[model samples]
Target chain A: MSSGETLPAAQAGTVESMDCLVTIAASSGGRRIEISGSGAARFRSAMENKIIQVLDSLGGPGDLSVTVQDNGALDIVLGARVEAAYLRFREAMLR
Target chain B: MRRTMLYLPGNNPNMLLRGHLFGSDGLIFDLEDAVSRSEKDSSRILVREVLRHSGFDGREVTVRINGLDTEYWRDDLAAVVPCRIHGIRVPKVDTPQTIRDLDDALSALESRASVPIGATKVFCLLETALGVWNAYDIATASPRVTAIIPGGEDLAADLRTSRSKEGTELEWIRRMMIVAARAAGVDALDTVFPSVTDEEGLRREALFTKQLGFDGKSVIHPAQIPIIHEIYDPTEAEVEKARKIVAAAREAAARGLGAVSVDGRMVDLPVVRRAEFTLERAGAMTEGGAR
Candidate 1:
């Protein structure tokens, strides 16, 4: 609830086939996103765009870190996971 | 038309995306028992997205939400009711009051989502002995109720027994369910046959329930869909007789006669209705035909 304080991390989804696990945490620096796993090689840029779009839609803060470990989940699943993880992170911040 | 409604885990994208291809009459994207507690939130999100983006190939789509007792039920309704699903299958429904409460919640969500109030149907899963006992009341509790299903494992446990291959445990419950569902003018859907590997057992159980007048059975495996449908579908002989009976009844009505006979058997209003139902089940009649 105060500046200089770091909110705990929150995550959603799993590493199962056709799924992805997304984790969000507070960052002191500018926005940071990490993508890996099955989809990263071919869909890295698109996945990044998707995460940014979802975060912007939710009004996510600039000082946040988003990490996605994919398992061949489609774009819809990725967006959903990111939104869920971000919402959970925001909830944790509120607490 | 819901001869088989397949259950797809809400969080499993593989199943969620391809479940309809298995050819069940309907799909039940499950957010309750199939999903873990920790993944509840993410599963809800995933199911919502799937509903929004994926195509179910014209299969009747429904979602099985957590019971009303859980904190997730309301959120579940909020997520799926707006997606324009065919219904929600509610578990642990023990009383008419439970249906009333669920009806209210559904109405609220439907209104908020701009869906017509009462547009979403309710499929009641009678999982407790008390729920089975109150089946008639629960079925008649709301207009939104489309089907009342007697549970397998849960109901057997509630009755302090285990499931038997012969279904000795659920015989009385199945009989009672049929009576109550008919009395309440709702469909009685049988619970899943757990022994998926036992094709013979599945056929036997499907035949039994079909004979008892169940509208359909919940299917856990894709392999079980055709088996249940095979049991529920009207046979060639049955369809032919039903067609003849229906034609005779229609001719009798046209001739201003109050009595009719088919194949030397007296065909009354009930018999005519049954014939028409047979034709309907055979897909010989168009939707809403000759009711």
Candidate 2:
């Protein structure tokens, strides 16, 4: 999915057992990522680092509101869900 | 030893969550035909996430990526190449070049991901008439390739034929693909049974394919697994015969003989090899090469 157009507010992933739900909302300011769940405090830095990696990978941080409803999903799972949400947001714009 | 390989749509969380409990020899997280075009990217993410967190519990796990002709496959490879998957199943493989190109890309990706070189395997799916003809080349294209699967519906359409309950349309294709797989020293998995509701039909097809010597069959529904396994797995008598053959072969080799007599029949290298493979599949062969 290409950038430049306004991203549609979209969400991906789930909050089901041991999974986290990540919702991506379009923003005009910049990428805002947050995580709240079990052990969220302990893994906040790691999760942020992963979210930053995802944003960099997509060349994003372009106007996005992030909400992570974590449920003990590992860093990789979190990253995948975030990337999916990001891609969903971008893809929604194309449609 | 892959009697049943189930295709679990990658985008469906319910499937991913429940797939491993079905007792299939492998679970193929499908990112190609199973996902809608709009959900492609999200599905890739879901697959990658599932790879990390799903409790596979020793079952073989693989991802079937979109055909290399698509724009989505690049991202598919990039996302899945580094994950702890047994292999990647590339669909619509019509040429050896496709395998070569994918292997090269995967090697590069593995390097970037700090993974062991050639850690991942590749399985090719022949979905086109051209792909069926080129199965040998595709199967032999890379050392990483472990199996070549022939797909129905698509293949039937490609061949300008219609699918039937009797499977006469697929007989020739299955035979040719098995020969190609044999020539390339890889397993050949028969196509799926489209009617998931037909347990009798599934059993018949599985038995027929097993008699044709396919190492496995693809399954879409969990209900079909046990029937496939029952058909493909060697019977108790066959396992016993295999064990005896292995023992006889071992005894013959110890005495400097190139052949062994088992049940008044001469067992040569080929027969002994078959026996050993049977024992291996039956899980009766020990680490010391004894059953």
Candidate 3:
């Protein structure tokens, strides 16, 4: 079995206005997603659902940790950022 | 009547989502210079999603891809061409070969995506001295070339100079672009005037380019849109004169005459055609002109 420590982390997006910073890392257990920043107070659940939807579409989250630092990004932006970060993370893990 | 085409940062959600509402003639989502190197991949994804999900309010939407010299251009095209964009603005195009290469790439992408081949147009940005020299060749390079534009800062740098408020550096290049575009039967689009705050300067440059036979100008700021439109839109007096000339020409044509007289001046085929073009620019030909 592979350890999470052997994989590298990957990120996408920036914490700019109407944008978000999404980072994904290898996880040893079940999939986990965390949301924070200016949009988290009111949009944490919605953002989490978006992350889940994108990750699932990309062939499931697998064993990974997704963290989002949003700054008032729309749902579409959030989905794009999550997909980008997860793809990067997946590429890194494969490498 | 594309008097102004505004540039929207590809990576900025706020701009990408709302740029069409600013009342420009078209919108150009910029993925080349506006996006940083580190964010190229992410920006490409973001632009694709935005194009997929958001509507541009029916404005002509295009994207400026990275130059052919870069590794990211093919990826950029693969991302956006499938989105069914109207066209792509390719920068630093120096010869017809560049356009041939781009056309080939786009055809493969469009075919793969089930899009109609040749539906995706190309707008060439002639930024270097060689590019400007080969303007006609580049414009006629492919059937997909709808317009050719002169470069602003990039062209200036390539010419070993910097931009001036009076635009002394780009005058000859602009002239050549208009001539070449017209010779090639394509539209001549002027580059952006970077001094966004200089209203008077922008007006002067727009007027100059319009008089030089440019179809439109690339806009950097939304505020410049109204001014460029004002310059390109036909005035009331001009429209009225055009209508009178068109009416006279219709009567003459009905009588099988070779020439007509409008406002006590002799009008011919060319003059009537010019009047019809004026009516077209005023957006009144089909609505209020002689059939």
Candidate 4:
């Protein structure tokens, strides 16, 4: 699911795009996330690492897919967006 | 150098316990006016105990004692002056001689208690009409006097005027008190902003006081702390402008010039000094990360 996708469908998979993208999955399998951007590979790795940390802390058993839109955002900001998506997904799951 | 001194009633244990977090530069455990005659003794003892046990964490703590003319003055000083408080706030101070007399008594108490005279300072509350008129003399009465605060309610009572929310009646008094305090080279503090709900009014009054050269304003309620701090804190634009001005001045000085120009405005010595002070204050505020 991308940030544009309001509600996730019954299926879980990874989606990617240039503007904005998101990945969602159920917590049955181990979570894996990877991100790449235009700026630097180091930045992408940092963002991926932070999102994984947040997901691990949340302790949900789901196959995770993360999408990134490289609109010249810093690694911290990319990580923040992923964290926001995770929080929203968790909130929706709770509901 | 108390920039903001909050008045906490002596009998309110909740306020006493939370005094340190009020964001004021100092706290005055008020024993006079706030506490009734019947509760004075107990309140004094409680305040002393609070001072002894409560960890104020370097916040200046002063006890506002009952006036010397009152019978409770002796007992109040005997109970509190020996504690590790910062200063003694004498209310209803009307004359230089009155402050001198209080100073003498405080000196006696300090000597008898074996505490250093310099440790226990004095702050005068100019409450009466006569006190406001003689504020300058009272401010300079003794070396121990650190600040002169106006008591709006009593001063209005002495002047036979009704208290107004706008504080129009006390405008002249406030101006005179600031002038007197500046003339005496001591900190001038404004009276309490009575309305806790009227934060806009409080900010207006705090800015007025800051403009009039008052070091700080006294607050009656905890809710007024953020408004006062907001008024006193340098604005984002001010901080940025100050940084630019300071940088320009430093560059100009390095080039053997006495002045610099920033954004087509001349940055002279005084402007640079003001900018430096603003930066220093901003640095102090952000030392432990943004609050």
Candidate 5:
């Protein structure tokens, strides 16, 4: 079931204090999320859940690889960054 | 007392992202007047996303929505009131019904969002002569109102005058607003001085605002924060007097006296409360109310 469509790869936000830089790339699994860096474990589930929620809101949950460079971003910051990256990927894929 | 409130453009993600860096007592994310018509949708979405995501780090967070006549205000309210917003400022408010309507709208939004009733506050931006005349009614119209900001530029236009260097044109409205705010038990905030580079002028104007009983002054720039905070902070002598009044009042209460004498003047509940508030604002008071 391949229509030769692939979501674009893009990143949004920075790994600054109280912020999270989200980089999303097209992939095979429904979702592949990895967190690497300090202070990621405790918030790993929360961040992943938020990313899924944002993608769902954007008509997503598509196959994707999400790399979150965490810097203590709140849920809303994470959501916005994820949403921005998702839109960017979606727009690029259409073009 | 709110010493300084910095307004950041709501549409710009960078500014919205960085609003909490400055040490302001309040942060206003402005959607009206700051955002152009074309960018309203994007800005509205961005502000909502930011609000949905960011914690304001103890600073009071407010969003200034477009006027009721605009097509975007309802959307703006739907986006922000559900978030962690402390207050919503409806700009160019000319009638008490404006406040009443906003209150009802906010209540509906709160119910829709499942947030507690009356959790969100509102600030009336008295930007026109009609708004100024109805300031008292607008301030007291809703229990959610916590502050009234006397608008400078729009208000000047409404008054059919231009802003003067000494602010003579806006003085009377400022006076009236302070009375209205005090009578309504809400904070009266002064408008921003348009001249950002005029440090001396800003200081002078802030001093005038403080003397006129303004709780704080709104700023559109970060540089103006310290100048306004300095003027609003209680002076050293005033802090000392506050300490004395508080101590005397506490001792008198312990001695079963209804009123206390501070510096040979009889002090009562109101003065004691004022003294305690002064110390609190000065950041010198602890649980014991002493330096």
Candidate 6:
């Protein structure tokens, strides 16, 4: 099984806010990111920054686009969504 | 109020006539993209005549009109804007300016036909890449704009991505569009789940979108209506939980308490708001009972 095949339970305190819809779009070659919503703009930006940091650490040569619909979700939950999307994309590429 | 807005070709009388029984909350008499160029006039006349006589039992009736950039738009507005439809859906909206133009044209048509100024609201379809980028502006362009729906087929084409069964690629756009709608304080609708034969896929996607916080979904077939509603409607467990939360909150308030505890968890203002939304959803699903 590929590393991205598993659905990890959301970790406690992973998301700092629960008022945003987190969407991560990542391909095998590059990534594009967008944060949207009127409330919790700062949190969304911070989450996007962390996601980019993580993706840069992974050193995966692919395009990734992350869009956050901020509804005040916790930071951990936002991280989990980004990880889940990256894993899902990795799994699809493996397939 | 529309849970499932079914699209029917403007020229198809049989579909239009049987629309009420489809179990959709609204019917969109499609004259823009679904009908051919040559049949535009005839389709408008047919839809108008049908609207004049058809008794849809107060189902929200919407007419999708061609963009103002097209030659047929003026005639479409002149013909259908005066009809007793609930709203006019404009296709391929790229900017707030375009929507303003549509509003102007609608006003002219409404006045020319002696209709009320605000009788018909506008529903904007963000089809192209540029349209999606400007979805928020288009949604908030006018007070008459009630809903913003993404056209997945056109969007996919615009993005030059193949439509996948999982729809992962469209996820960002869908979420962004919903955020835009909510920011604008209007309804955000999901595009139709094609593949009428894949009912399971349809249900799964509907549930996913509902979880993503869309107000409703666009459906192509009658069979998809119930599935969409079922996904959208609050579950029994959720309703029960909502009832408990509301009851606890009410009791706490009566006792001069600022908060309530339910299931050993403290419930605050946000929790109450969620419970209220849950109850409202349950009420909408049921006829009169709290269940």
By TM-score, rank the candidates, best first.
Answer: 3, 1, 2, 5, 6, 4
Model 2 off-target regions past 4 Å? Answer: A1-8, A13-23, A27-79, A90-95, B284-291
Pairs clashing within candidate 1:
none
iRMSD computed for candidate 5: 4.1
Taking the tens digit of each residue's C-alpha lDDT, what string does model 6 give over B199-281?
88998888888888888888788888888888788899999999999999999999999988899999998999899998888
What is the C-alpha lDDT profile of model 3 across A1-85, one tens digit per residue? Answer: 4543466899988888899999998776888888888988898888888888898888956788888988889999998888888
| Residue B261 CA displacement from its true place in model 5, Å | 2.9
- For candidate 3, give the docking quality class from DockQ: high
Top candidate, metric lDDT = 1
- What does candidate 1's lDDT look like per residue over B1-291, in tens digits? 878999999989889999998888889999999999988998998999999998787788999999999999999999999999999999999999999999998998888889999999999999999999999999999999999999989889999999999999999999999999999998999999999899999999999999999989999999998888778888889999999999999999999998798879999999999988898888722442111
lDDT of 4 at A42: 50
Clash list (residue pairs), candidate 3? none
* Off by more than 4 A, model 4: A1-95, B1-3, B248-257, B288-291
Clashing pairs in 2: none
TM-score of chain B of each: 0.96, 0.95, 0.96, 0.91, 0.95, 0.94
lDDT of candidate 4 over A53-76, digit per residue (tens): 756766744665555545454333
Show where candidate 1 strays beyond 4 Å.
A1-7, B284-291
Error of 1 at A70 (Å): 2.2
List native contact recovery per candidate, as a fraction of 1: 0.89, 0.52, 0.81, 0.00, 0.26, 0.00
Backbone clash count, each prediction separately = 0, 0, 0, 4, 2, 30
| 10 residues in a row with least lDDT, candidate 4 chain B | B282-291
Ranking by lDDT: 1, 3, 2, 5, 6, 4
Write the residue-wise lDDT of candidate 5 on B158-185 in tens digits: 8899999999998888899999999999
